[model samples]
Target: GQQVMQIPQYQHVQEGEDFTTYCNSSTTLSNIQWYKQRPGGHPVFLIQLVKSGEVKKQKRLTFQFGEAKKNSSLHITATQTTDVGTYFCAGPPDSGYSTLTFGKGTMLLVSP
Candidate 1:
């Protein structure tokens, strides 16, 4: 069995500040996926990191994969109220992506 855990279960940041959330897994992962869920909306796929030491960015957001493929992180620079949401990190327990194990999630709360 595999487990995914996220830290700083909740975060509060002022607008224009920066925010980050880290994810760790008990077992090495083949790939990791990130999802964002707004206050009233369902989870939306943010990005996926596959290769070791891989890093990707979307606007002010950056995603990183650990060299060991057992950890990941998401950072938001100049955060905004719109960025408020619960961010989840997920990894497949087996070989396929059909099933995924998700972390408890880090909930980001941004204020003006």
Candidate 2:
């Protein structure tokens, strides 16, 4: 079975600071997806990476995939109170159905 894991389970930052989270997979991934869940809200898809050493950015956020395709990272600049949420990374395993396995998630809290 394939597994996705995230580091720094929790983070607290002052408003206008920065934040980051890392994700790793137990097995090679065909693709990886990122999501953000607001406080008490459902997970919202952010982006997906398929190629090795790929990088993508959305406004103040940046995402990267390792050249080995076994790890990934998300970085946020100038964090704001609106950025408080849990970030997750998910990917399909090498076996069986197409269901995705999600990482434990990194929780971010921004204080004004």
Candidate 3:
């Protein structure tokens, strides 16, 4: 069985501040995905990484995958009220199945 864990279950920041979250897997992953869920909304896929040491960015958000493919990170720059939400990292284990295991998620709160 594979397990994904995220740190700092919650984060609070004032407008214009930055935030970051980390994820670790119990087993190596073939690929990893990131998602965001706004208040009362379903999770929305943000990005996916398949290669080792991959990095991607969307506007003020940045994502990174470890070279070992067992860890990941997400960073947001200049937080805004609109950015409040929960971020989740998921991935499939070395197993051959397509099912993915998701981390607990990091909840972000932004204040003006």
lDDT of each candidate versus the true structure: 0.93, 0.93, 0.95
Off by over 4 Å in 2: 94-97
Best model per lDDT: 3
Clashing pairs in 2: none
| Model 2: how far residue 93 lies from native, Å | 2.7
lDDT tens readout by residue for model 2, 11-106: 999999989999999988888899999988999999999899999999999999999889999999999898999999998864545789999999
- Candidate 1 per-residue lDDT over residues 61-83, each given as its tens digit: 99999998999999999999999
Cα deviation at 67, candidate 3, in Å, is: 0.6
Model 3 regions lying over 4 Å from their true place: none
C-alpha lDDT of residue 84 in model 3? 94
Tens-place lDDT per residue, model 3, 47-88, is: 999999999999999999999999999999999999999999
Residue pair clashes in candidate 1: none
TM agreement with the true structure for every prediction: 0.95, 0.95, 0.97
- Which residue pairs collide, candidate 3? none
lDDT of 1 at 86: 100
